[model samples]
Target: MAQNSYRRPAALLAYEVSWEDLDGAETEVSPPKLVEQVDVPATDQLELMNALWDAVTFDAPWVPETSEPLRLVGHEGAKSTHYELVLVGPSVAGGSSPIMTDPRFAGEHDAWDDIALDKSVDLFLDQILVPLVEVYGLGNMAQLDAARLSKMRERVRLIYDKHLMGLGVYLKAGPTGYVQGMKFVLQEMVENSAYRLDMANMIRDALGESAQNKVSIDALEARLTARASATAILAVVQAVLVGTDVGKVMYDLSASWPEVAWSAVSAPALFALSPSEGVVTRDESSVKFTVLPKGATSGNYRYRWTTTGDYGLLSDLLLPDAKVLDTREREVWYFHNSPANIQDTDRDNVSVEVFEVPEGATSIPAGAKPIARMAALVRGDTRVIDPRLEVNSGATPADMYDSGETYPCVEMLLRFPRDPKAYGYVVSIVGMGGVGDPRNPNYHFRTGNGNVDYRMDNKIGVNVSDYRGTCAWYNGFFGGDPADWPATEPDEIMGSGGYDASNETMLLMLFSAVDYDDDEDLGAEADLWKEWARGATFEVFPLYPEDAR
Candidate 1:
């Protein structure tokens, strides 16, 4: 058959044969066999291939084809004949089957291998199986309605709020406060064993009447009996009373008591047994009570002390809880001395000194001389005076008295006071010489025409007169002319010398008294005779540590 033909021929057969008897009897013959030609359409051939492919694809444990021949048989007129059928075309021995090679059925033979079985199973579970199980299987066992679930959760919350929250509040009220309220209940319990019902009713009244049906009184009683005991209650009371004032507890307890016979009479009687003030160091303490009404004395009373005091004895009463020892040394000494003459006869004239007074001593150690003295002129004058002198002298003169001057100041590298308690110090120009009139002393005292200024560490500048008569310790100072000083109070200079606790030493510079005069009365010759005296003082302040406060 042509491979591309739309129709193919198939043979149908019927067979007949005449048999002769061995004894030469009459032989019987069948009717003539018939043959029919059938045209198997191409679609039928493809359908047959597809059927075979589906069997191989769907069946588990598929068997590979073997070379055994296959036959079809039919019986006719008591005789049976078999016809062998053979599949002919391109052999599928070492390559793909003819169905797979065909253009119409290409890739159809192995298409089953490309199927994603996992995805199909997942789709079944996600879309079909899961919803069916949830709707029917779980629905029969649980209420899955959103409204019913919400109501169930709300009921649980109501139970917690009505019962558990009230219990929490009652317990947090402390043994002293809540125990008094429960005293009547405990006394009732001791008198009668059937107290669980009463407790449930009491809880319902305290929490809400709606909870009467929800609370299981039997369960609550079982839990309470398992956890609570008289000995434990007494231990709690004893623990709270230790290091506590017993008299205060009695007074507080009395204030909450009713005006019944037990409270009015028995409570006061019990109070008489406890000492008005006493210490309780142990869990148990013996107390003596005298019954004057009955003319009897008893020593069986138990008392617990409850004050939060450092000293627990009657003799140590009224003492502070803790003593604050302010051991900081606040003793401050002011060391002042006058340097008789400070002058600049030559250029760059400067005098340096080391002024130190021992603690508790009034004066500097004897024979302590200036550390350095040189003929180096150093002076600071007002800007107005400095320019005028430069113009008149036809030469620019250095303003050595300014704190920034390095050459000609009386530089004192003073150490912080050795006292560990010392935190800060105050430097003051206590007194000055060459003030012609005490009543009208020139606030800006001058040698010739140069003004004197003091500086700390070549940074903080202040006029000597700012500290003249006042003992105020300021952490900052204003420089420049007095007219340029701030009308309002100047802002404080942070890290200035006054309260600086970090710096171990500070450089104090006192500028030289130099000749810068241009006035006729103050001659150039007056620079030789110009002299001044300054008396400065150092005072240290004490700092108390935080613990001492």
Candidate 2:
């Protein structure tokens, strides 16, 4: 034919050789068999056969770079990428078919592109080959132990002695050579081997138990990573409101109320209706209440209280959870003026109103005590203080009618458009001078009492300056006339300098101009409070990141 082009070698087919028959005698005649030749297109047939033999016997592939093991074709002339093989069928004696199965082609073949030959070989050897070898070795050991238990025990003693030497507890046989001395060592060695087997069994059982428990551990991890509950959000609100140092409540729901559901009810609600609505009657040990307006169409109401108790005890109102209204920051307004007037200047005679009722009661009961009312009234007859007067537009001077003295007090009202999807908060603040009030512990030392003066860094109650930007600013008077106030702008003031978003109780800020002396006075100190009342403003808006939530 052509020049021997198959340079790579081909492996000898198992069918190429004859084996012993059932009689245990080697057969001399050639058997009827199918043989394959290597398909590598080598010009030399002998060289191709040699390469195939080496690949199978020594585990080296024909192409070392590609690392693909050679495969045999049925015929000598079968073509491959760079080789060809021949398929031949030689007749044996008595015309029998092939007897032995081919073990060479038993394992799975690798895919063309992603195969890493070395790694695949390593995996096959470790996962399959080593296990198979260990199984065969264990079988042989079992047979040996069955036949020679006494000898195996002796072997274990020897192994124990070797190990003992490594552990620095070896006992060598002395020249006296007492056989009794070695009996204890043999017993210890045998026990050690038994202990090893027990330990291995224990380890295997632990692994199996861990595998069984894996499902539960995975589920718990998933639950921990899921979205937090509504109770968590409520806790965040409490933390912002009532902790100690900064005074925002902090408690983990997992530890504090583990049994509570996410949507469970909070503390009970206490109510206080306008007084003119009805009258309250006394019940035995409990308060019975009712409301009566003066006229049906007049909208005027009056409340009569008959509950017999010390009014001071009513300070901690008791009512159920359902009675409280969901007003967001509007709740601040109800408590603002009801408890006590925060704007009073007199230190010693400061007065506050305390109420006592059921924990969840919605309306204020008649006959309930309203104790401790102190009035250091700021303007008195000099300036008229309209409590609920609404401010719509423009800079207008509120009339101050005290002893014929008239000073102008400017008021501002802000209204925000309602958002259906977003939660909103409104913050109101009054300005103060650089020196904080000596009486208040929450004072910040940095800012001045001006419309524009603001505080910077703030944390908790540690320093004076820090409190400026925190809660509602009601410390002292700001300095500015309405004309001095920015006319073109919304007259809104930034709280970062003193009043901050974190301490904002409510969204609305109500401002008033007050005369320092009984007469409508215009001294420089009076000007300061007057200016503050006239021109001061606060910012109000939503707090959290809407998109993120």
**Model 2 spans with C-alpha error above 4 angstroms:** 1-353, 376-527, 531-549
- Candidate 2 structure quality by residue, lDDT tens digits, 264-283: 11111122211111111111
User: What range of 10 consecutive residues in model 2 has the weakest lDDT sum?
Assistant: 258-267
Number of the predicted model whose TM-score against the real structure is largest: 1
Cα lDDT computed for each candidate against the true fold: 0.25, 0.24
Error of 2 at 239 (Å): 73
Q: Per-residue alpha-carbon lDDT of model 1 for 1-549, expressed as tens digits?
A: 111121111121222223333343433334322222121211112111221212222111111111211121233322223221212211102333333343432332232222212222222221222122121111211112222222333443444344323322232233343344233333333343444344333333322233335446566555445434676434433433332232233333233211011000001111111111111111111111111111133232211212222221111122222221111111111111111221111011111122333444433355654221111112211111111011011111122124221110111112343334533233344343444433212334333232333333322244221211011123234556543443211112211332223443342222211112211211122221122321323333434455236
In each prediction, how many residue pairs overlap at the backbone (N, C-alpha, C within less than 3 A)? 14, 91
Stretches of candidate 1 exceeding 4 Å from the true structure: 1-177, 181-227, 238-491, 498-549
